[model samples]
Target chain A: MTSPQAPPALRLRRIYEVAPRDLDRAGTVSTEVRRELLALGMSPDVVRRASVVCFEGEMNMVLYSEGGRIILLVKEDRVELLFSDRGPGIADVDLASQPGYSTAPDWARELGFGAGLGITNMEQNSDLFKIRSRVGKGTVVRATILLGVPFF
Target chain B: MKLADLAGLLGAEFVTGAEHAEREVTRAFAADLLSDVLAMVQEEGVLLITGMTTPQVVRVAEVMNMGAVLFVRGKYPTQATVEYAAGAGIPLLAASRDMYETCGLLYQAGLRPAKRKGFRLDLPSGPARPAA
Candidate 1:
């Protein structure tokens, strides 16, 4: 086995273990991540955008897929989020990214979310956005926001 | 107006965060939908007015870093919701007034709803300096 690596100076300050497929945990994770980001010197505006995007993504994983992990990385200039999961992959990337497009179940909609706007909001908020997926495999989303970028 | 004033005006009772009554409130939003709240409200000192009382309400408050939550229509959220807010350090309050009445009272008190693209938060960037 390889030697373990040291925690980066600017690294994830908080780690939350959420049950796979637990939608309720989505909100809790979002709240804590936002708090940690703020404490790391991220602006409120950026933190809000990140929090919303992250929460929506987490909910998606719980509702549609087999659940996953949301890793928040705090860097000197930006906060990088990595969402990884092992679940059915997005068959149509373009369609999935479209605003108002979602595969969330009925229960998710009743809670006032899963409007297909989750990914759209994430795209709009983050300075950089990327997604990798494969059929019957899983999906990985990486989003980054500059620390001081004006969200308005 | 502060949360205490709004609570008193609406005759609402506190579920938690009674101590935060002294905190200043600069804005407010009325929506039961979490998506709209996420897309619209961004001010830190916002008073979220919603009829929907669920864990999502507290979650919304947490993610948005809202000042306080005022549940309209006299709806009181579950104890779990209250506990969630308390743990998250968010203020939670309940109001018996309907959505319209609650919004009117807050509006009359100069707590304007944010109107901007993405989200609108009207606040000074820096601490206020004492007048010379």
Candidate 2:
């Protein structure tokens, strides 16, 4: 008898790649994704959670990374976000996740972000969150927002 | 409270979306950080009061489904910001009062803080729930 084959991975309905150059561009990308999610009939609370997660991830990429890409995966029951950047990776993920701790430059503060709330905000808004980094390599963040359920 | 009422209370200048001046504002939230606003403001039709003059303010309102944005401390939005708000149908108002004063006046006028439903982490334990 032939061995049973594993099930195929879930197919994504849509994928949006946003490269944020600055805050304005970041806002644009976030807004576009939010619109798409809402159009898919996701609950308002769920969409808001996804929007915040996306915005924070986008801003972090623009601020720290040389430039990175935000990949939004629209699945049937959840929205998955992957933020990958090729920059000086975090030496301590635990320390970086702490609120009120920041390595952002002065310019980032002038833009009204870099208050050290980016990662915490992302964690708070996402149901399933993970961060992987290696010094001198890069950082990748994955956040998942389950659909249909109200976030509140 | 009506947008026009809140405008009069703050002595705000309507830069755009005058057509929506009469829309009701169910709640009010004030913050400079866009992330804080996104995380805290839970209700639709709430008024956003902020000191930030960047276009991201309007974007926040649009993404969060806010009723309108009231710029404080005499900060007027740029033309591009006004155009964006108008295009999105979100009313924009500017006031000469500072953040504290704006909140004070709005409170005096009976506008209350939006009751935010607490944020919850819904961990997937078993099978994925069916989509609604």
Identify the candidate with maximal lDDT: 2
Poorly placed runs, candidate 2 (over 4 Å): A1-21, A149-152, B115-132
lDDT of 1 by residue, B1-132 (tens): 877887788898888999888888878888876766776765676788888786877887888778988887878888888888888778888877899988887788787886546432223245688999
All candidates' lDDT scores? 0.77, 0.80
Write one digit per residue (lDDT tens) for candidate 2, span B23-108. Answer: 99978998887766766777788899988888888888988899999988888888888898899999999898899988988888
Pairs that clash in candidate 1: none
Cα displacement (angstroms), candidate 2, residue A33, comes to: 0.6
For candidate 2, the per-residue lDDT at B22 reads 78
Please give the range of 10 consecutive residues that has the lowest summed lDDT in model 1 chain A: A1-10
Cα lDDT tens digits for candidate 1, A33-104: 877877877666777888988877776676677667788888766788888888788898878877666776
Second chain TM-score for model 1? 0.85
